[model samples]
Target: MSKDKKRADLDEKFQQLRSMTNSTSANKASILVKASNHIRKLKDKIEKLNQELGSTSTYPNTENEHQQDSFPKVNVETLENMFTVNVESEQNCPGLLLTIIQVFEELGLDVLNAEAACNDGFELAAQGVWNEGAESLDAEIVKQVVIEAIRKWMSGTASP
Candidate 1:
């Protein structure tokens, strides 16, 4: 790419990052710093939420190593009818994948691509599209449903 074209592309990406982070700084460095701070804040919030979820719930251990410590951290972003979702936990989750998939189906999201690991800690990153002609959805709604699924799965109400 030409020098000017590369600069323009960089500026465009910075503007997008500023919008996403709700940063109002005009300087590129400030924008980046603010975006970094925003990410740290999000991580702190997720950790706090996981702690709360784990502390408030108690379940009988059935010899499965994953029963007691399985609060999933979820983050979701949406653009138009497309979404990217991330879910993770510090402990294994035996049946959460199916519950989350069921939530996606209930919300009419078609998984376009997904990567998951459950043998150790649970981690899932997925990109999906809203099914054609389905009801409208947004990032917050998707995040809520995913967290709700995790809670239900934790409570043993949702079986794989």
Candidate 2:
């Protein structure tokens, strides 16, 4: 299928997910389970597309056609509402720490604590405090921002 057609289909499925998620009507156990399963499948499809499009990069450019910057990978394992970010970088450039701290600050999240490995490898260990009463975060968005930041930092555009 064409990219546009695939996008449209994804959108349609996403709208169905939203409707089902927000529905107030009484639903049978099977119906709710099916709806949840459908949403999960849709999410998987989106993830596959993201991987194909190099969504982790700052942006894919057709002109460059040969950009070698791959998105930094991150792992977040949390038991509660708190999340711990572990960013891994291959080049380990300068100012990446500051950029990450600034991202949290700009989002109004307080940096409760942070640590990083020295020049040998680029890895940041950070804990952030979100608003006590704020809405829950979108995990995908958080991951995307961190990955994109790492990509930018790797590209040597570590400017604030």
Candidate 3:
């Protein structure tokens, strides 16, 4: 059968399974299991079709690629006497705190205290004081430098 015809048939089968699952009956659990299996097969068929059409994505077509790109949010805040940096990523990035310390040193900032924690991803907060007589260093500049340093580390161009 042609690809279009095959896809249509699979979609019809999926609808039938869905309807079976929704019906109130003693065999609902069995119907649900069958529906799950059918869904998996349908997904595989769709993936194969996508591959044959020259798509390069390895993720299933149902997943949103943009959502995957929206992670790893970074923020920097500088106070009158201290600077704070915050990072939220999808995965824990090792040596991130050390890299922040290194960036602080490179920017002539004194590390007064730093703390980092992680659960699903990572959250790093670094507090520091500017070097004495460094009147040029401000919140915006410090934030920019910290952000750039983290970006470099994430891109593998820099290390802790």
Each model's Cα RMSD: 9.7, 11.6, 21.9
Which candidate leads the pack in TM-score?
1
Comparing candidate 1 with candidate 3, which one achieves the higher lDDT? 1
CA deviation > 4 Å runs, candidate 2: 1-71, 78-80
TM-score of each: 0.57, 0.51, 0.50
Off by over 4 Å in 1: 1-70
lDDT ranking of the models? 1, 3, 2
Tens digit of lDDT per residue, candidate 1, span 1-160?
Answer: 8999999999999998887666788999999999898778756655564464454223233455464445567889999568999998888888888999998987789999999998879999999887886643557656766776787788798867
> Model 3: how far is 7 from its true place, Å?
80
Q: Please give the range of 10 consecutive residues that has the lowest summed lDDT in model 3.
A: 53-62
Shift in Å, residue 107, candidate 3: 1.0
Cα lDDT, model 2, residue 9: 94
Tens digits of per-residue lDDT for model 3, 2-114: 99999989767656665633543336466678667756764665555445434533222334666445335566676655677676777877777677778777666887776
What's the lDDT of the predicted structure labeled candidate 2?
0.60
Give residue 33's error in model 1 in angstroms: 41
Candidate 1 weakest lDDT stretch, 10 residues: 53-62
